[model samples]
Target: MSGPCSRVDHMPSENPFDDRLRVRATEILRELTGHPEASFRDGQFDAIAALVNDDKRVLVVQRTGWGKSAVYFVAARLIREGYGAERGPTLIISPLLALMRDQVAAAERAGVHAATINSSNATEWDSVLDSLTGGDLDVLLISPERLTNPKFRTNVLDVLLDPSRAGVGMIVVDEAHCISDWGHDFRPDYRRIGALLDGLPADLPVLATTATANTRVVTDVAAQLGDNTMVVRGALSRDSLRLGVAPTASAEHRIGWLTQHLGDFQGSGIVYALTVSAAEDTTRALSEAGWNVASYTGRTDAEDRARLEQSLKDNDIKALVATSALGMGFDKPDLGFVVHLGAPSSAVAYYQQVGRAGRATDNADVLLLPGTEDANIWEYFATASMPDEDEAQAVLSALSEADAPLSVPALEPLVGVKRSRLELLLKTLQVDGAVDRVQGGFISTGVPWSYDAERYAAVAEARRREADAMLEYEAGHRCRMRFLAETLDDPHAHDCGRCDVCAGQWWESGVDDSSTSGARRILSGIGVPVEPRGQWPSGMATIGVPLKGKIPVDERVSAGRAVARFTDLGPGQVLRSFLADGAQDAPVPKNIADWCITVLKEWEWEERPTVVVGMPNTTRPVTCADLSRGLAQIGRMTDAGPLSYTRDPGSPDVNSAYRVQNLHGAFNVDPATAEAVDGQVVLLVDTEIGSRWAMTLAGRELRKAGARAVLPFALALRG
Candidate 1:
């Protein structure tokens, strides 16, 4: 796995660093850092020289805080200056908007004007392009997804690649590890970079940089960079980071530990959770404990995410409870600590995330509090990135048969894959040359493509191996720092003697009883509001459902309540195990029954339900009926029994159109139940709400059968 370059290794330049280029790059570096004494780190100048002086491709694998960004910022300025008035702006293909914003600011400090085009700043695309063409920009940053945008490809990219024009002076790939499927965070759009490189001039300078990437990922990315690629690899050890793991018995214990020990960590930091619900729940728990914190997850709006990131940087809060959405490209010089509520599936991912701490600080604490449910969460994420062959074929076929390009919404009815998965599949197909994203949407390129079943299987097996490695990490049998360094294939990996096992446990292990009780109180509280479906899914008519646009007011289900979300900390963990796939059905547990009644009592609605009715549950009939009967008896409402399914409603895992079609006319209201619900509000009970299509359809049936309104109540709501 060794590359041409090792720690402190460099390619012999045909000539020593060109004196003029070196002097100019140093000036830019000092300006960027606001430190007149700042100079390039060991191999930073080598990488810049390779690109600017030799016009060669370069790959840099350095640890965090190693000045990988400095290499590019200096190189971009030098290259633009080399070409004089005929110069073209340097092009940077970044992975995240946060990273882009950081890079843009750094570029400005270096006196290099820069701009970005991304989804967030769509209206600014024309102005950015104007700056690029007018030679008013030194660096232009765009995401990999921008390459798939038809307009950008035709107008901006084509012009940038044209040699006859003032094409780009150099190309930079930030977070380059994402280009490889072998990497921990592989993104399909990154595969398009290979094509982009192929279109560029052979002598054009290019540089790819990342803090995370094993030997395999390095080899893959280097190959994608084409021949004669200079590799500048460095030791992957963070001297300022002290690593440790705290084994947790349950969700309550994990929350309890955070509530007690979070305030002890120095300065502001981040607390990572595996899921959005968990992050938000932890934020609430910590805030209730009188800690100043906020939640940052994928569900947070872009504007709020920006605000929260700024708040954390300004030390306005103690911590930000977050998921992986806060993982990459967030820079905080003095971030004091990073704690994970659950272990990530791969050591590579854990290293990348924990790298966010101790960047410029003298020391930072990094700890992992592993839970029993971590494995289940790992399994869910392991397969989420892989492409499904059947879903791929369905999307490709739909595009092939369309007269014109079909938007994702239009193809939803023809293909049964969920929107997120379907979009991922399309990007994979686009990389494989089987499809093209056009003006309206997507179009098949008519390129013959076969499912790479073997490759996908290999990726899945690799995921399992990573998961096993994570389990070993949680065991604490060896030095934690050495384990991560070795896992990333760092040749200098050695026992750091700074970890919990290398030394004695440096922090308190026991969580106080009061903290545990507080965690229990926070976790056990019930009543998650269930926002009902307001409009029928688009293209429902194409599936023969005859439904379109806003649902009728009379037939709409009222906003309701649930005992808890399936991703909640305490009750959610229990519900996850109980409702997991292939689990046998049983009557509602006594504790669950009490929780359901508590949720009902706490729920404040516009109109209270007068009757209880269970949705048809072929899988959990006993549990559904028990819930309906218990709620009716406890709340003094009439029990109307369970509704009957006219036929099997089929699988609910498909897309909206297909899922709605499967349940459109599937439920029936019996004469006795219909009469009993006359002019009355009904409480519809179910074991869980996934797509919520079943509840919507059933509510419509009840409304037609003399019910004035329907309120959905469930044990859990699946994200």
Candidate 2:
């Protein structure tokens, strides 16, 4: 609870072998770091000693460059080299592939045989398993998600946990903050770690290390590790970083500033974005401006992510415009700068990201380019990640009623939740004992589960508080580093004397006219392809739609175009304002109408549409009608008028199954329109596309009514 550091009041007194073990650890440290004569940092030796000599559960809270990896590697090496009677492979639960790769390389340098079992290396699992049980592997790394993997749990993990055999000599949890629900980056799979600890041999030493845990996360994780866990927390401040925040009025300005000033940063680093679309947008603008950069996002392939990460470390590119996917387990000792295109939701999250820079460098820059839309993006993610109570109950009920384990696809229609969200909720339920993920899919555990509304609400409130603290951080009312440190309850929080506030804004602010105009010109060209749905939801038959598998090509809508995606950084902001929630229905803005015309002109379709038919617009009828009429008038096409909905389809915001079901029998093409649609390429128009079921169903009706082709177009595509 004290200032710069905190530890257990009483450490096991020195053993006679302590000095010898320290000497050996120092030797391994030097080898691992490739730094001759290298010595252990302040708390590194103590942590290694606690794990190896005393057989203790240790929680190490240190800054990014504090060599926490070295402690574990050294301890594992010592344990395997006969430092104590207990000996086998040390099982390390790491979160990211990048981290595993780096740790394995480091382990090799220390004469420790390390291999990882992750999704990317499935073919090598058998060989890796052989090494693990054959005493040829010193450390084995796996992701927390592997714990629930039925095959992994049975084939490899069971071998590691068999008590009659040597079993695991030690366990290491990296990025341990994720184990706590209160933490900024909590993952449901990490909660299974508590169960892992409980099942491990009581005397087996376990080590949990993180650079981001605050006092709350620390206490929670320590409690999970059991009563006898010893915590070693050190100063959270980094002397190598000079923090700053740059305020921008709009997304364009932020892009412009990066275009103009990113080269001014010391060296290769990251340009962080709040969303995948934003990251891609930034990467495009930078690449067009001739800056060597690539986009990194959740959508990036695993192999591409590895290559890109290495590229950044090699300084082959100036920066990586990335989402939070690049946050943890990335190592670049000489990473020169990190600039956030938008603020993260919490100060702790920001600290962890910025901590990536200045880890092994003398002077690195950390700047936050705050945008006006930061709060909106933060709120969107805040609500998006939380499990909906209704959805959770629906999933549980469906699983309970099912005769067999239900796959995600099978559960989606029954639960009416999207696939990604349903998967997350299932994971949460699995961790909470309400469900079990088996070989085929998931099954209810027959446990009476109660939704913990109070706990979720408390977590939400904590998130809000963190958001407010981030705002305070961006405001620069106090030292940036100190504010983040204090928010994490680091008693040693002090003015870094080098932040924007402390040193009077070290960042170069403002974008020049040429750069701003260039960014605007690049972002202004907006025509994103809207690929038509090729298949119906899997359980459409159960929903009485009688549809399944691939949609008939003759009934399908051709790939169409949207003026812009609502998630786009440039035109998106303007389009979002025009079609925001509760926004009144009005005529299409002239600029947007002109952009739509541009998209139409650029569209090189095999055949031009002869008729424009607007889909029924319950939410924004005026806008949809205006868009259709304007396009018809501009393109000299027939304005066949809007399609009618026989029954209200309700909100289009529901899950895929219900959305498809609602729109199945809803469309009504009048006799006149059906006659007009005969042997003609019909342009199907809509104001916005959310679930996109409306467009698909309407196109099907049009195609059924003898239209040669249905080309679906929308003013905006919603994410």
Candidate 3:
């Protein structure tokens, strides 16, 4: 006690373990029959001893299978010797009762005075509390749930306030990321820990640790610990892991793949599916295929879960088929692989699950089998059972009244819905952009609090827009990966040189590389526009007229020039005509022509209103005939046909011959007609202007007779 504490100026440079403490620790380790020569592992011992010398706590976070438990065990042995009988007891806060029990049992084997306080230890709990209050316990492990109880809080405060006690020396918060809302395995009680720390003495050394802290979660944990806490980050990159993605059509294929792979690997692994049912099914299938597999889900009992986890650790099972619930607290060093049977809704979940593998060493593999129906399932989950305006308002009001995080169990009755249904509603609300889930609960995103009902309605309408957009993209003849990358705003190159898209294995035998290149060029040329232009007979109607010398044709001119005339306006109102370029003194409405030109300048001519002019052959009305031929020629040269042609080809003088073929072929019966044709099946299609127009015209006629599929004319032609 007098060695480092007395020398104020020398504190910084003095050896963490002075001669006396070192002698004491060596004597204690000898008595306990520990590795007497195990002196500290150079740098590791130096770090721990230095922390002890400064009275500053150190947090050592080891992955589940990375020998985390050893950090504490070794530290305890070292501290027992260094401090002798004067050292304060260490407080270890364990999140789970089973974990605490395991730790206490392990300590007892090493002759350490480690005791656990929980509901199960009724008689011993009281004795342990008394002993801790009297400064008799070396280490105490308790769950956070117990801290919520008033009795436990009072007992802890009483011990901290006792003058005879050494006070709480070092506080170790294990699984510290559970306190952060952004963590995958968040616990509401973890949030209350900040308040608990505030009640303790300011100078109390604190150590927080977790094996799974990503960059975000680590920042959150540091903030929760208040100032003066140093964060030590470990490497996130696992070198031994080989990441791979597989494209599969169904769950059957996933099971087959797992079976084939697991057979070859022969080490322990985990296969994660979407739901509990899927986990069970895949487990059974793998079992039938002669693999020793076990299933784990939220519904599994605590005891059974422990047994299964132990079996996995003991290599009694070759594989574990589980939902996302299994790997949080369990650590297996030799876990060789992690397979995702379905697509994760977010990248965060994927990162967390994949992180579970390769924690012990580098020889791990992460396999992701993204089924074709995965996106459909994700969309279904996102859009399922969203709360209506009234229900959302009710939930918001209830949440506003509560001071603490409320679990779904406690919130359901207040919101007047079944628990399962409420969960689905919450998830849908998250997807629909109404609320954000923090920790285990959710908060409104100010969307439902819109002052204008119309604005709120418009925001709500975005859900339909998103669904429509997804349907259009998924149903289109394109590369799925390209579509996904574009939707997600990822910086995907023309070819990732990976993915099904780059490999030419996407929808319908994959997209043609030449066609894709040409399509991209066309889109690039279309460019971003400023105004909307109405479809016309000839490509887009020319706005500017050739400025020729003024030809004052009062009221009588040639039939060609006098096709139509308006003389009621003021003399200053110029007449408008369509010509490429001429003189500036043209008699045609120059003002009106100028206005048209301005409008065209703002619009995207190549996209919606497609601009087309006469092909030098004849001024016989620049019809779609000339436009289509030119476009078709371009397409043939580029090998990229099937271009989208606008409804109006701009020409009003005469109908284009090409329009007869493309227009009729493009027309499709509307939703009403499709509904009438097959009432049992839902037709998910784009609700564009042309499609709606065709539907309105043919709906009644199609339903009146023997219509079969009522499919799009394009699809029908393909069939």
Candidate 4:
């Protein structure tokens, strides 16, 4: 098997630095670095020479801070100069918007003209294209999504490919591991690159670079690039990273340890969580402890994400509590430390994330505090990666049966898959040529496709192995660096002199009570806003409901609250298990009820509730009733009784429209309770809010029954 260190030599170059291309590359590198005397590192010169001089496809799998960007920028410049002005600018298929922004700025600093044409710069596309066509740009950066966009592929890429027109010289695929299914962050859109590669001429030099590819990823990526792809690999170890793991008594130890010891680390760094809710909660805890920090997740707005990233890089904050969404190409050199709230499922992924730190500085710390619930999270993501053949067949059948194309939302109820999953499956099928996305959503192309059961099964099995390996690493039997290196198939693997095993545990094991208390206070005290439904979902009429347009003010609920999210680190883990499918139905546990009370007591409502009412469900009716009664007793509010539904609405797996239709007229208030709630602010309680329609309909009933206002509350909000 092919690993990063496994090299396939191409046509060799004569006089490595004597040629004009090499000299210019060196000069360009110097300009980019702002160091006039700076020179190329090992394999940097070779990779640049392979692209610009040898005219060969190349894969560079060096650790972060290895100056892979220099190789590509210099090669693009030389290729543009060698191919002449009539040809198109060298195109780069970058993975992230942040990465593109950084590269674009660096290209300009290197005096190489560059422009981007991704989603963020949609407004600038007309002008960016003009510059490329006008031969004013030397480098063009774009996301892989743009490569598959029909309009862009037709108008921009096709035009750029023509030698008689604005022809192309070279292409760069940054974060190339994304091309492999074996890659931890495999993206379907990045797979579109194979089509782009096939369309390019045989002589066109291509380069793929990544810092996290294992043997499987490298082999898969190389095969995609075809024969004669030169591999330039480097050591995975970062001497500056002092790897260590702090074994904790409980999963909750992460936050406490972070709260107490974050300042102990040398410089501002990152605290990574597996989920967005965990990151946000961690950010809040750190900020509450007077440690300056911000939450970074996929949900963070584009502009705000950009601003937060800058703040972290500038060291204005102690750290950014972030999820894996913050991974890949987040350039922060001189980062003081890297800490994980929980271990990632695969060692490769863990290494990739920790690799972000200590790029420019010496003696940066790397710590892992594995959690009890990490295995559950790993299993969830593992299953999510494997496509269900039954679901895929359902999607294909639905599309084929339809007379016209159906949008994601339109097809949601029909296919019985969540919108996000459905969208992903459609993209996967589009890649398989079973469906095509046209002007108005997606339509079936009548292409017969096999399920490929064996392939998907194998992928699922690999995920299981990765998870097993991650568990062993967390157990800390061997050197952490050695374990990761061996896992990644890094040929030069050995026990590092650092890490918990070799160094005999550097960080403390037990967390202090003060920090632990602070964590409990924050975790138990936290509650997320539940935005009220403002408008009726479209296609409600199709689902046997007459509702349409914005919901009237009186029928709508005020913003509500949930005691804790399923992703919260404190009671979230316990609460999740407590709320699981086969979990015994019982009254709300006193401890959880106490936390719920804490959430309500801390919630600053405009009008305090005087009454409490529960939404009954067969699954956990006792819990729901107890929650309402427990709150009513503590707050000295009256128990206004349960909202009665005429019939079952089934599970909340249906779309918003179906959900609304199912619950719209199902809830009702009895005469005695209708009189009891008159002009009183009521707290509407439920064990969980899945569709939110149940709470919406219940709140509407209470409002119509002369309640002054309805404030919805739930133990958890399922999305």
Against the unseen true structure, what C-alpha lDDT does each candidate score? 0.85, 0.85, 0.48, 0.81
State the weakest 10-residue window (summed lDDT) of model 4: 1-10
TM-score, prediction 4 = 0.76
State TM-scores per candidate.
0.76, 0.76, 0.49, 0.76
- Write the residue-wise lDDT of candidate 4 on 617-658 in tens digits: 778888888888889998999997788888887557544555
- The digit string of per-residue lDDT tens for model 1 on 1-719 reads 12243223543445566687778888999999999999887788888887887788889999888888888888888877872224588899998767888889989999889999876555466778888778788899999999998999887888787778778888999999998888888889998998888877768898999989998899888888887688888898887889999866787888988899997799999999999877877887898799999888765544456778999999999999999989878899899999999999999999999999999987999989888889998887777678888888888888889999998877877897766678888889999999999888899999999999899998898889999998898888899989999999998888988889899688888899998888877667877766677776654554467887788999898987888887677787788778765577887888888888788877777888999999988888887888888889988999999999999898775556667788888999999999989899999999998767889999999999989999998999886
Please state the error at residue 365 of candidate 2 in Å. 1.0
TM-score of 3: 0.49
Tens digit per residue, CA lDDT, model 3, 1-719: 01111111112334546776555444543444345564432233333443455545344433344434444544555554445333566677777644675667566655567787764343355678777766566678877665554566677745754557666556667778677655545554565666676666645556666665555565666766655444443333344555555545455555655655566553788888877656755665566557788888754534356567778778898878888766454567678778788856554345556666767675776666766666766655544433456666677777767766556766777888655567655654544445555654666665655234564355346434445544444343354434433332333213323334334432221233443343333222211111111111221112122212222222111110011111112211122122221224322244433332343343322222221211111222232233323433432311111123235332221122222223332334345433433422111111111212222223222323223212111000000
Ranking by lDDT: 2, 1, 4, 3
Of the candidates numbered 2 and 4, which has the greater lDDT value?
2
lDDT of 3 at 24: 47
Model 2 C-alpha lDDT per residue in residues 1-719, reported as the tens digit of each score: 11222364224334455678878888888989999979877778888888898888889988888888998999999999989766789999999888998999999999999999986665467788888778799999999999998898998889888978888889999999999989999999999999988877667999999999888888888888876787888788887899988765687888988998888998899999999778877887887788999888875645567778999999999999999989887999999999999899999999999999988888999988888989998888888778888898899889889999998877887877866688888888888889998977999998887878899899999999999989888888888888888888887789989987988978778679888777776566787666677777645565567887778999999988888878776787789889875688999988888899899998889999999999888779999999989999999999999999899886554456667778888999999999989999999999777656788899999999999999999878876
Summed backbone clashes in each candidate are 0, 0, 18, 1
